[model samples]
Target: METSSRFEAAIKKLYTAFHNNTLNPECCKQCAVGNILDNTDSWKYLSDDHGNLSLNYVGKVHQTLGRKFNGYSPLELLQIEATFLKACGFQIPLNHTNKRPENPTDNDILFNGLSATISLLCEIDNIPNVMDYQKLFKYKKTTFDYIVH
Candidate 1:
């Protein structure tokens, strides 16, 4: 079991879980990178010497999804993740305690920001069917490959 294979298996498991409606976003947020690292056995792989498993795994997922994942960095991936969540109707947490802004364009800005992130990730990770994220959020696809890798 190598790092790449492990990464593929983990992502596949995620894909299956997502399709089965059993993945808990809350749990994913809690463990984040650590969860992937710990689950390598289920997937069968290990991190490289540089602790670059997350980036490498994302790249592999991108390739497996038929998109290029080398163009962006983790920060960029974070941005995309934020946007994707927004497009899926998830609200962005506001730092200000004041009431939410009443502007309609606020949602548009949020969506564009997310879309840009997704597009960038798709380019870097070589993910296929960039539109699939939108579809997945909309529950249109039974299974979708949107991993940042």
Candidate 2:
């Protein structure tokens, strides 16, 4: 399956961040969209709150102007963050009172978050989920000749 260059770049960056232990939901510069944007916190301006899907005034302006950061609109960035946070067991619009995983950096939690984010990215690009490894299990049947020992 073919994927857009932008998607490929974003996924590569995300994969690196995940393995490097730099992906953090609580930090703007290390979050899902942040990593996609090369670990820049500038995407935070796209939304008023972390994990918020609604874009603020600045985000609206960018979206209206047809601006894309790392090939994603401001709205898409916000949605990606929201999806990551949700998959990581974080309550939307992250706050002190919201429920969240005890260890946000846990491998399992981060993996789930990354998986969901990748799915969303694929959805946005109308491509198959890259993380789906089920294809590797497909096997071809072949007739085998055997001799009893």
Candidate 3:
């Protein structure tokens, strides 16, 4: 498969895993590692360089959900988690940002719950993925060794 296509597939796999609640914390960590391996060069841009990609991803998620997660609520964390998953390359429709929400659907609830758990795991563990690390600390001057080791 082409590089872009491979990346898309990986994103879809992660999305599916998150949506299904079939992905454990270790699985998400592995996914993050795989993403780093696949997009190592992107890390240079995310860290010690351009940090806009991380902002874009987070902004897009917040914009879409119409709320900023305070990092305390599981639902908010899930939205952020889904955004991270989409950053892998799922092509989330940004145009849906302003849409009205009648009620949270099952898929929405599932994704939200899964994202919350995933986000907590990511925050607490060593995400061995360089890209993930970059996204998490792109604006900071801290070295990778300090964050990962």
Candidate 4:
């Protein structure tokens, strides 16, 4: 299936970060959007609080200006981060007392987070989720002929 260059780039970045032990739900520079943006924290300025789906003033300005970072808008980046954090077992908006995984860096936790983030990315682009394997299990009908003696 063909995907946009942005989608491909984001997947590659997330894959590298996941395997490199750089993906962290609590860190701005290592979060899903951060990795997608090449480990830059600039995207954090797009929102006032981490794990927030709403864009702040700066983010609003960027969105209004049609500015896209790494092929994602500020709002999209925030949504992606929120999705990752939530899937990783953290409460939205990131409070210290909120429910979160005991080990945020655990591979399983991070994998779940990455999976959700990737799903959201695909949704944003109106493409099929890359991690979805259901299609592979679908049965297809084929015609066959049998001759009886």
Candidate 3 C-alpha lDDT tens digits along 1-149:
22233334444555665555444322323333223233233222111212112335544445466652222222333334445445333333222443322432335644543454344344433343323445665684765655665
Can you write out model 2's per-residue Cα lDDT over 3-64, one digit (the tens) per residue?
99999998999899999999998999998988999888998888888888888899999999
3 against 4, candidate with superior lDDT: 4
Between candidates 3 and 4, name the one with more favorable TM-score: 4
Quantify how close model 4 is to the true structure by its C-alpha RMSD in Å: 2.6
The residue ranges of model 2 lying beyond 4 angstroms of the native Cα positions read 136-149
Model 3 lDDT at residue 48: 23
Q: Compared with the true structure, what per-residue lDDT tens digits does model 1 show for residues 74-143?
A: 4333444444444434454322442333442344543443344435444545555353556666654477
- lDDT scores of the candidates, listed in order: 0.38, 0.92, 0.37, 0.92
Q: Name the best candidate (by TM-score).
A: 4
Clashes of each: 15, 0, 2, 0
> Candidate 4: misplaced stretches above 4 Å?
140-149
**Shift in Å, residue 80, candidate 2:** 0.8
